[model samples]
Target: MSGTSEGPTPAADLNRAVITHSDLDAPPCAEPLPYRSVFAAAPLAMAVVDPEGLVVSANATFGALLGTPAEKLAGSVAADLMELTSDARSWHSYREVLGGRQARLRCTRRLKHPEGHSVWAQVTVVPLPGEGRGVLLSVSDITTRRELQARLRHLQMHDPVTRLPNRTLFFERLTAALDAESYERGGTGRIGLCYLGLDGFKAVNDTHGHRIGDRLLTAVADRLTRCADEAGYARANTPLVARLGGDEFALLVEHSTGTEQLADLAESVLTALQGPFDLSGRRLSVSASIGVVERHAAGTTPTALMQAADTTLYWAKADGKSRWTLFDPERNAHRITRQALASTLRPAIERDEFTLEYQPLVGMADGTLSGVEALVRWNHPQFGTLTPNRFIGLAEEDGSIVQLGRWVLRTACRQARRWQLDHPDEPPIFVSVNVAVRQVWDSDLVTDVAESLADTGLAPHLLQLELTESAVMGSAGRPLQALQALSDMGVRIAIDDFGTGYSNLAYLSRLPVNVLKLDGSFVRGFQYEERDADRPSPADEVIVEAMIQLAHRLGLTVTAECVETSAQASRLRGIGCDTGQGWLYSRPVPPDRISELLGSPGVRTDVAGTP
Candidate 1:
């Protein structure tokens, strides 16, 4: 017998012990019987329902499950289950099972109990073997499990913070879309991915803390999602969105009817992100850089597609950021080569493959030697003698610049010391070395300089560290402090390529710097100066004079760089420029030639091999 209530069984009590089982089991009569028990029992509310959907019997467990006695459950029509608040789907399945169509049926149904609580149960009904007249129904509460499954599904498909599909799910859907495109009515089955990142994401994290950063990321996710939907042009289905990680997000646009579809989609994404995002009460405005890669035109593999997008994204960042770039294989190839080079740089350094040459900084007054700037070169085993331009930027990107910078600093200092030993009587000349931003940030730059000075016995005044204004400004918090400490340690600092960064004057006075090497743009103007040019081309001479005076006022020495003509040199000296460097002095050359030049008296006046 069975019941569908939460009370004990009254039917079994009234029926008393059936003599068939008890007597046959050998309890009261004689020998042990074979047929001990024939019925199955369930630890949940259950009852027997006839083919016409009437309750035939109620067990103790079923009575207890429904909070009613077995007597109350018996002889009730199964349709009366509606009084217990089962949903329509459950009732329909129950009827279907009773009609001889399904052998068993299970469903999650709601129950409104007398205790005023709504409960959920996994209800299973199966045909009883003893004749088709009855059915055994079992119910188990699985409300917790159902909810857990829902939560698990949510997490598996989406990012925890942004609530967007993660990389795994995005790629899965993307692969499916690409496969579908192959069979669909489209041109070359093209799609597009807009890989985007917030421009000032780090600043947001730093200034407002990560708590706010998380909120900002969520806001960005919403903005990107909306943009993706717009780009998708939905038409039932055309686009999917996902947050790859951090400030990075991706949008997959499918069945791109034309190449213009991708371009339009990119524009829409950019437009959407241009607006301000409201995060809590903070109206945060941020711009994103997007890298767009279209399928077929780009590639078919997932890796190739993502890489192309990433390369284009970097191009967006490189071209002043807060913009979009379409992937071009030719441009991406260069980027791939640079990435490969950056990864190989440290090992190359360890292999002792880097070399240095000196470029002269000539004195404008007499066209004589001032000093040489130490420039680095990489004698790559595969690609011969690469100049600083080829690898220094790469080093900076990979944070290998610190190690490379140390090498250049030490080597250049040692060479300066060697020159001093070779020409002891000559005026002590300075050897300017370029300092990478990574070196300033990672290493104890002051300590490196101090130790290098002591190790080489080179004077602190003779070793100048050349920094671009951008490098100084780019160094945040601790790195800025490091620069100050290094300056305080008596090492002369020169602002290389000066007049390039805006707002430089604000930091100029506070910086304990010694020299400003005017950027080549202004210096190159003097290259056209003719021997008989009237009164120094008033504009160039006046501008040069103004710069020199400004440097003098700031107590900073001025060095005119790229001084390639005699007339330019004379004009620079006339304008009170203290030093100059250019092809006019010497192109960067080998160390032995530098040593020989210092030894030859007449050669200094001609200004060849000065650096």
Candidate 2:
């Protein structure tokens, strides 16, 4: 090759010839041919851009991505193809790569296409290895993948049937709101929740198929969402309505004004659900019970809030369905205490932490001690001494009453036997023990009483088993047979707390009951002083008189309970009540005190009201 004035010199030409020969001899196709083929046929849309961000070269794939011809893309700014390039932060990053400060840059962006369809592109740019300092760009369409991921996320956070936010998302949003409120200055904003359960939903599920139930749930969700939207309009942080699985739904309201607003929302929800639902030509009516809890977000957690809501919901159901109940701290504390006592009840029985106190059942005619009622008390380590009123219902609920009742029966019999042994001269004083309804049904009461009497050498007649009037009236089959067997075995069965339950006097004639212990309510009216000297005895006194006469006719002795004052005692005595048991005579005292009373010659008639 000859040297030209404006072209390569002889040495330069020689160098060029050597480089071309090396490239031709190295491999089969070692030139730019393979790279060009890959750039042309690659699935990814690719381009080359100059330092100013203008497109220098574009491939067919790149043209197809933007809905333009490859030749027409040249000289156009590459940033213009990406919708997000207009953002300051995105533009800054783009400038960094184009200025050669960044070796490579990758980002996801929305790309505008001429076909009027937007595309999501994962764009990657790297500096080209040449003097021009251009960048090679690659774009991947991730629209379908992104849409699929979004759908998966929705499925995870929403209920499939109701299409409402599920418990997971509800908790997440609640947590987020709580966190945000915590970071606020001064006092935190209040947060409120409405936990709702559909009443008689299980009935619907049982009567109708699950498919119809599902449809009903969907309809309920729609109605709830509309109510939530309406309630949340004037409030900040729109309430998040969610289905917490199976006929239970929740509404989370952040930045609550007060309980008034929450109450309004709850009322609105109740009203919304009042209308009957039309499901596939079937009209179904349903109601809901809502528990509303509102408090400042400072010390609240998602779990604690939800727990309070759950407790309140239970109260709503208990108080009667189709109503809303607000969270009351005092009531919740009482419930929690009851639950703690319940959890410790079985263990208490095992540990022998129970003790019996006896209150004298005295003769109203002579004001002398006749028998003592065995009242069980729990010597709880944590709560000190607890009365039956605090824990008896709890024991009955957990089915611990059977064991507890047996223990009481055996203990009372043994104590009564001891008292008789101590005072051989004194008349045999009976020990009346209260029997729970569950103990009657779940336990062999006749056997228990017989064994106790046999073990202690005490007569069955001295160990009276007192059952509530309801228990006696409701007894049938085995329970009735058991009662009859006990009655035949010479064990006295007194109907306790008479007139407090279904007072069926006709049914009383059938039961083998020997005594009727009138309920405290009948005696409470006698507590009031006689304001007018000429006025007739109070209605309660007349009722007591009539009941006493009726019991006398039935050959059943009548005992007055909870006589707090001497006046009340005097009236009960005047009404022909056979016996009296109350704080007026003596509070429930330990066994030793009872021994002293039994040994004393004259009856201790000094009356003292309950403290």
Candidate 3:
């Protein structure tokens, strides 16, 4: 049998030698011109072992391989000389070959030399061709081959830029750390990792080139390695710093004390990388965001750990760069839920799993229904009815807002026209629909509004479009043109969540806006019982009143949002606000419920919950 390692090369003087079992009578030997001469002249490390497991004869090559003289090796135990029985499986196979119960045995073994260093040998044992009693053992030197393989493996497992372990090796170590046996080495039984990414790195690459980018990465790696050394718990417990491709790196700690250790390591990395790097007279400064994850090694897979680290890293970036974020299971759960929501949002639109709930926007003075705001609610099959706050940002990100906004616009218009038809005797109630910035830019807002009004027979004057100040503050070019076209078509425009943005209020007159719906935080201050008329009002009350007067002066109506109590409503009315919408009137309810409340004052709060 041949081993995975290369076999021994034969010399021109190679000859076959056979011997009988030492315990039995000698077998007939033909043309035996002294078998020892043949063994002595062999180039390979050849040894003849008797059935009783003693070295009967060894060639000079075999003696030199084990560092023992051939003359003295005659009576020695061959297995002990080579330490062949160190493991059970190999020992059993050797015994089988010695007993002539097996045809052959081939295996690799590391044999220690008397001279300090070790030699790798491919050892093969076979029964002499025609003889039955003894086995011949051949050991070949494979140290050079093994060294070449080691060099190739080293090149394969490391990053060229950072000269650090690459993704493959990092994951390999992480997986090994979680192995059950790893915890037995007197540890805290927990593993931790700091997954980091450079901030604004692409700008550096695009500005300079990949060569400079690689140098920056290498510099970052050196700092990380130094950090790992300083944070080392012991001589053998230093953290492993690895380059995970591109501008990402990871610092892994095994037997971690706790999250605090991981945090310290992450903070050190951030601080180390903060200093300016002068790359070939080009000064460059950069920051990093790191995600830290530390937990018990048990029951954790490498993939799960990395996923948590990735989520935390994203949070660090989103919360702003140059900071480290620790993994929060609850936050991670919410993130997972959001991911699930985003993946399903587009399909939900096509499935028609959405509905509009109307909240009455009443005349502040008369306490009568003036109009209703259309709020879209997702009737998710898995998560139940979800408010707009839960998924609107996701929709805008994925460009599904165009599809969703169109549906809401058409549905709300059709319902408004139906209400007008149902109550021809009462004054017509307008429907206010919120528009996302994406809808204005990503879709043709003018065409969508025009089509909805034309399709539903709802007058354009009765449909109001509400957007946040940030969405409409700096409107220009296509966005400004779109808003102008909508207003020219007679659609009322209101800025939703007003006063929350930092845009200039002077621009209000320049915009084609028709209304300002005050942010709710300002109105929450009105919760204090309405003070005497002459007394100074709360700061928020003063602010809201000033805003209301400003809007009125600009010829734009004011709608005070989040008027949850009668006191808040009365104060808004006393302040001369044009309209009010909140729980004080009624929570957003189904369209059918709106029909029931039509032609009536804002009275019922019968809905068990608000969307």
A best-first ranking of the candidates according to their TM-score comes to 3, 2, 1
lDDT of 1 at 326: 84
lDDT of 2 by residue, 1-611 (tens): 11111323332233233333233235645666445566667677888778888897788999998889988999998887865365676667677767766655667887777778888887766656544456677778999998998899999999999999998898888898889545385333888999999999999999998999999999999999998889877655578899999999999887788899899999999999999999999999999999999998988889899999999999999999999999999999998888899899999999999999999998888777889999999999988999999999998998999999999999999999999999999998999999998997898888888889999999988979898887888789988998899999999999999998998877878889999999998888765546875433577667888889989998999999987776787778777889988887888989988888875653454535421
| TM-score (all chains, Cα) for each model | 0.57, 0.81, 0.88
**How do the residues 1-611 of candidate 1 rate in per-residue lDDT, one tens digit apiece?**
11122322332222223323243225435543332222224455667677777786666766766778876887787556633224565566566567755555655666677898766776667655434555666667666887898799778989988888998899887776666545365544667788888898999888888988898888777877777676656364556889888899888876566657777877887888788877667787889898988765334777778877887898899999888888888877777777778878999999999989998776666655668899998998877888888888778887889888998999999999999988888876789999877787688888899889999999887888898878765455877677677777777888888877853555677777789999887877764447654655667667778878878999999887887777777778877998888777778889887777774443343555343
Off by over 4 Å in 2: 1-33, 46-118, 123-138, 181-188, 205-215, 234-236, 278-284, 505-509, 527-531, 534-538, 605-611
> Evaluated with TM-score, which candidate comes out highest?
3
Cα deviation in Å at residue 183, candidate 3?
2.1
Backbone collision tally, model 2: 0
Question: Runs in model 3 with CA error above 4 Å?
Answer: 1-38, 184-186, 200-216, 233-236, 271-286, 502-511, 526-543, 601-611
> Tens digit of lDDT per residue, candidate 3, span 1-611?
22322332343123332333332343437343455556678778988777777887788999888787887888788788766787777778888777767766778888998888898887877765445557678888888999999988888999988889999999999989999998867788899999999999999999999999999999889999999999984645999999998899999999888998888899888889989998988899999999999999999889999999999999999998789999999999998999999999999999999999999888887777889999999999999999999999999999999999999999999999999999999888999999999998888889989999999999999999999999889888999999999999999999999888954678999999999998887887666645564443577678888888888898999998888876677778888998988876778889888888777755545354342
Question: Which residue pairs does candidate 2 place in steric collision?
Answer: none
TM-score, prediction 2: 0.81
Quote the lDDT for 78 in model 2: 89
Error of 1 at 341 (Å): 3.4
Instruction: Return the lDDT, model 2, position 387.
Output: 93
Per-candidate clashes, comma-separated: 24, 0, 0
Residue 479 of model 3, lDDT score:
91
* Backbone steric clashes in candidate 3, count: 0
